[model samples]
Target chain A: MDRGRLALSLIALAAALALPFVAGPFWTGLATQMYIFGLLALSVDLLLGHAGLFSLTHASFFAVSAYTVAILQVRYAVPTTLAAPAGILAGTLLAAVFGISVRTRGVYFILITIALGYVVWGVAHRWSSFTGGDNGVTNVPFPAIGGVGITSHTQYYYLVLAVILLCALGYRVLIRSPFGLGLRGIKASETRMQSLGYRTSAHLYAAFVLSGALASLAGVLYVYYNRFVNPVASSFPISVEAALMAIVGGSGTIIGPFLGAGVVLGLRNWVSSFFEMHHAIMGAVFIATVLWAPDGLVGIAARLRARFSRPKEPGP
Target chain B: MTQLAIEVGALAKVFGGLAAVDGVSLSVPAGERRVLIGPNGAGKTTLFHCITGTLKPTRGSVRLFGRDVTRDPEHRRTALGMGRTFQITNVFPDLTLLENMTLAIVGTDRRKWVMHRAVAAFADVRRQALEGLEAVGLAGRAAQPVKLVSYGERRQLELALALNTRPKVLFLDEPCAGLSPSERQRISKMIAGLPRDITLVMIEHDMDVALGLADRVTVLHQGRVILEGTPDEVRANAEVREVYFGHG
Candidate 1:
């Protein structure tokens, strides 16, 4: 990390840490949502931005994890110590199975993931006896360990902020790693990568599962924060929105997804207050982003910075 | 007394009722430099693909170091000491040359799976990457992305990517496919200077580079080997003139 980026991250951390005490409850809650959804988007980008696999089934892992935590905790009275890990493990296991989808590429990969996601959604929506149908599993409390537990939403927000911060740091390391570069190489040219002796399919499969695990982590965070799990959590729209968040912010950067989540959530919150056609507006925004700023908002910001900082000297 | 490095037995590849490579068999001894030359659409590239496992032969088998690898996938072929450069300059355009070399250096090894450590932290990888770039005369431009470099430089990077994999048998599909006279000489010289311990099979349209570099030449016409011999025999043959040299 450069000095400027490090300083910016420190400032963002400080602001996030101080948000609950400094800002209103609504803003803090919104920030928490942003972090959670941003993490989800980051997971999706692991394949989308790096491996060039556009998966439409990440929400399956997210909802599977959330539902696992909800059922294990609410119905079976499982402890947080057991339920949280089980939730993550269950979601990660689903991701491992779905990792087989990496055998396909481009449109086929996208279609397979879509079908896989729908299977999970169908189960969550139609399996009423166990899933509770549309009402979902409720009366879920905040996550706690032994006697030390979250008593307020503010505390949960801080916990989520902390976890996401750690995740971002880890994600940064992963992207800068050799394995990460390998993913980007595979994205650029799979044949070339194979010629260079990389087992491209295996590389992509690993990335898919790791991405799923991250999405599962996001799901666990979501269940604890929302206090419930429903079929909506597993729906197609959430998956699309998570991907859109990454694209809208910037697909390749770590902070981009979070910033994108904030933008999407903030816009939805503000726009729906007055306009009934907010979704149409969202569509327009996405189209504009794709057309005018294909690299997303971060790329725009970088370009602007480069333009402004260019030397004023006359000679080249 | 040389061991056979690559042995192909009656290989055939068919596409939509047309045979691209039909009933071709060739054996290359270890440490020999062999070149394949033919007119356009003579199945030279198709033959290269079949040998490298990029395109599976419809019939027959391929052996590497006397081991049958006919069923091996392209990547497994790579791991078993086979490496190739494409006719087109194929490389990671968005990555810096160092990164490109880094992938090649660690690709055949387990280091490509180290997800926790930053690539910058791998001092050996970085050093070897720089050295690999240096071998291609690209160390000065190590930090530049592949797309920013000239086509000739990308071609060099292509050869560099293949070479860094430490293959026992290396295949070059027109490594100097598009280049100026000077750039072509430079690349051909680079190929000629490679350690003779590694087996080399190359496809070249430039007969001067092909005949000059080959220990022996194989000429293909319409997917069958028409002739195989020393450069002098291939040059003076009346049949080669009609089909390949265009005049006796």
Candidate 2:
């Protein structure tokens, strides 16, 4: 990272560390949700921004993992150590199956993922015997490992903040890796990549699976934070919202998704309090974003910086 | 006896009712520079595509160094020492020229699967990518995005990308198709300077560039080889003149 970016990151870290103490429980709670969903959006961007695959079934992985943890911990009395990995494993396995959708490109890939997502949603919504119907697996306790445990929301916020920071750092490394470069090349021209000796389908499938695994991680953080795994967690809007967050923040950058999640969740929370149809306002904002700021907030920031810092030149 | 680097027997490709390549048979000896010349719709590209495993032929076999690879996928063929440049310039526009070259360098190896370390950590790949770019006269433009470079430079990078794949048999599809005379000379000089140990199969519209680099030339008319001979023999053939250059 450049010195400026490093400084910015340190300041952001300090602010995040102090948020719960200064802002109270509500803001801490909201900030916690932002980090979780931001991780989810970061996963979606792995394919969307890097590999150029638009997947609509991330919610499937997210919710499946959440439900797995909720069921294992609540009903079976499983410890956090086993249940968390189990949730990630279940979600990742589903992603492997859904990874077959990579065979089709463009609209077909989108359609297949949507259909697959609906299958998961239908099971979560209608499977009352095991999934607890619409009420879902509830009264889930905060994640506790052996004697050390999270006692309150403020403490949990710090844990989440730590996890997200680690994830962002790891994500930074992954994107700059050789494997990551191959994904970007595939995005530019699959034919060229194939001729360059890459199995484009295999590359895309691997990316899809990894992306699903990340979404699954976010889902684990979420159920513990929200204290339940409902059908809404697996709904289509959740997947769409995750993608929208990535786009609205800056699809390719690490911090962009987190910033986007803050904008989206903050707006929804503030708008819904006064207006009955806040969804319409959200819709308008998204349309405006697409029309005028297609590159999202980060792109806008870059443009503004370039404009302001451009050197003056003499003209005839 | 000279070994055959590439052998194709009765190759045919049919798209709907039209046969793009029909009953084409060819054999190129190892380390020989061969050029295919034909009119616009003479199935030269289709033939190249079938041989390189880009498009599966409807019928016939393709053998590389005595091994049949008719059913192998494109990347598999690339692994088996086949590399090709597209007729059109195809490259990673968003990535820097060095990044594009790096992808080509690690593409045929296990390093492409290495995700833990950054690409810059591979000092050897960086050096080789720079060397590859330098060979193509694009070393100075390594940090520039391919989109920002000149079209002629992209053509050069396209060839560089193919060379970095370590192909024993290099297929060049109109390597100088859209270059100015000087740019064409530069690309052709690069092709001519390539080590003769690597087999070259090229499609060219410019007869001067084609005949100058080709050890032998094959003329195709209506999806079949009309004549195969030395550059001088092809130039002297009346049949090639009638079909390739239109009527007298």
TM-score of each: 0.99, 0.99
Candidate 1: Cα lDDT at A168: 90
**Stretches > 4 Å off in candidate 2:** none
Tens-digit per-residue lDDT, A1-316, candidate 2: 7998789889998999989879978899899999999999999999999999999999999999999999999999999999999999999999999999999999999899999999999999999999998999999999999989999999899899988888888888899999999999998999999999999999999999999999999999999999999899999989999999999998888888999999999999999999999989888878888899888899999999899999987897
Chain A: TM-score in each model: 0.98, 0.99
Lowest lDDT sum, 10 consecutive residues, model 1 chain A, at A191-200
Interface RMSD, prediction 2: 0.5
Please give, for residues A25-80, the per-residue lDDT of candidate 1 as tens digits. Answer: 99999999999999999999999888888989999999999999999999999999
Computed on alpha carbons, the lDDT of every model, listed in order, comes to: 0.93, 0.95
- Residue B12, model 2, lDDT: 96
lDDT (tens digit, per residue) of candidate 1 on B1-248: 77999998998999989888889889899999999988999999999999888887889899999999999988889999999999988899999999999999999999999999999999999999999889989999899998899999999999999999999999999998889999999999999999999999999999999999999999898888899999999998888989997875
Clashing pairs in 1: none
Docking class of 2: high
